[model samples]
Target: MSATISPLAPKKYPKMPVIEGVRIATAEAGIKYRNRTDLLAMVFDPGTAVAGVFTKSKCPSAPVDYCRQNLSAGKARVLVVNSGTAKAFTGKKGRASTALTGEAAAKAAGCSESEVFLASTGVIGEPLDTNKFSHLLAGLVKDGKPDLWTEAAKAIMTTDTYPKVASQTVKLGDADVTINGIAKGAGMIAPDMATMLSFIATDAPIAAPVLQDLLSRGTAKTFNAVTVDSDTSTSDTLLFFATGKAGSRGAPKISDPKDARLGAFRR
Candidate 1:
């Protein structure tokens, strides 16, 4: 936790709503910090479509590389994030750590390794010990529940003055869809493409390509517009996951980003 909260911090944190197909759990891994949680895992139900935007920095973190490769799959089962040891510029060790962590998360979620997404933030150039948290995946998967959004936000903070969270419930076609987002960053702003790190999950039935389109367009005016510093972080990342669970409740399947039915959601 940061000793001094940022003056720009929100006056009050909003109550985060639970999205139907997401479960989150946090653990204390002591990666580069002590006496606080430094690891987080978010499990998404099957059929979750994913989209993301990352820093355009020439040198990105190992987790950033892993996510860029996996994003093309457009599907996600689990997201693993750590707050200390950025896992950047560590060469072979960083890549090996990400691979080990992804494999461990996949096994815990009973999903393919390619479907696991990862992000890391904090000090760059230090080797992250995957062992610090990989063994906790099985337990985290079993203990995770859908209502720990606030805790999940805090667990992934590096120098964040406060946990950032936002939620919105809107009518999508005939069903109500909810969007919940969490972000962490107090420094290393001026994102070339994304914030320091953020994750959003919703129960809307949007397709991957369409979700990517929406996320990319939306980020331009939001995350991309904010700049706390001129430096772009190598670990900047933002991911959005949409679990198609709302389809069962009559939410229209949106495969096109320009569909008129997305009017409310687009706002």
Candidate 2:
């Protein structure tokens, strides 16, 4: 996090409300900075659907590869993100670090390693010391709460001067569903895919395929439409998750992007 806030930042931040089935926690791992948060963990309720889009760079980060491989499962239970280490260009060591983090997150969330998602940003090429913070995951997940959107956004900052967060409530059928998102990036952003790193979660009962379609379409107008210095980072990533908790409130489960009920959300 920078010592100065960006002048373009919104003067009045939106009030973020709790999204059901999602809990978040942030910790200080001293990865690069001391006495400040550098790690974030988000635990989603079981049955949450996930979708993602990554950088177009030929040489992406290890965590990007890890996430791409696991995305085929279309299910998510835990998301672990950190700053101070991009974990790119480290070859085998980078892969090993991602594997270790995924395993630790899986163990903490009591889910399969394939269901755990990870993203990292910061210094590239240098090996990330997982030993510094991997053990803190279990405690973070155990104490996670649904109201840490701002803290979670702050924890993933690298060059960002201010935390980026957004929230909105939309009517899905007769039920109102909430969506919450956080992102980090101040430079190395372009139109190749994600501008930096973003994570979004919703309480709507949407299927994985539907969520993927929605995200893929929405990005063309959102992240893909933004630019900063015309440089794309190897760690650019955007992940979307949907916890089907809203089904109990009369929100119909949607599996197709063409569903008419999504008209309001797609707008």
Candidate 3:
């Protein structure tokens, strides 16, 4: 299904560069919504570092569980996400569903099953039929396009009125770096006020721990302070990616949001 956008979806889409070793694709598995894309998958390089923030809810989704269990690895190559079914409950099935999704995405992307990341949004406590995704997996991959920016925003949505996107290009002297980000928010917004689900991709090279530190520090100012309905959602996620395309040495880690140098990117 085609995505719904406020105005021109394509032109308004955020074109995130395919980093040195990353590629992304989204599909419409009819998990919940019909006639529109709903599943999202992102494939990273062999050594891509990973950092994340998730819901503080006592109960979380299967994808959240899978990520929490493997986050210690601190590395990823692919990310598989689905909307229309939050999979927050349903016990074992939810967990199995997440694993299946991750494994399937890994197969298509040609990476270890564990290396695949997963996330889900929408209705909670319902069982997700992994079969739905299994059938769409191949076609979803074959039809993948590098220009599905707006579709990414529309796919993960729960009830967002407008697609949330932001971009910043920061310079590192000889070469400049660019950061493109997309987010979904509408209700269940109160966090520890922790950062929400934000995915940012950059063309600079940075260490994993350093990237994690950067995201933690950056959130205190932007995502953590916002409010939508005073209620927080069961799923909150954020990630930062370094395409390693800028060729910067020992990338600067800005743990302090006020680090003047980051001001340009932060804006």
Which candidate has the highest TM-score of all?
2
Question: How well is each residue in 177-219 modelled by candidate 1, as lDDT tens digits?
Answer: 9999998887767856544699999999999999999999998
Evaluation by TM-score, superior candidate among 1 and 2: 2
By lDDT, the better pick of 2 and 3 is: 2
Model 3: CA > 4 A from native: 1-20, 139-143, 193-196, 248-267
RMSD of each: 1.1, 0.9, 4.0
Give TM-scores for every candidate, taking all chains together and pairing residue i with residue i.
Answer: 0.97, 0.98, 0.83
Q: lDDT tens digits, residues 176-231, model 3?
A: 67776777766667764432456767766655666677777777777888775676
Candidate 2 regions exceeding 4 Å error are none
Q: In model 1, how large is the Cα lDDT of residue 97?
A: 94
TM-score of 2: 0.98
- Rank ordering of all candidates by TM-score, starting from the highest: 2, 1, 3
User: What local lDDT score does residue 89 receive in model 2, on the 0 to 100 scale?
Assistant: 95
Error of 3 at 141 (Å): 4.2
Give the least accurate 10-residue stretch of model 3, judged by summed lDDT. Answer: 1-10
User: In model 2, what is the error at residue 157, expressed in angstroms?
Assistant: 0.7
Q: All candidates' lDDT scores?
A: 0.91, 0.92, 0.69
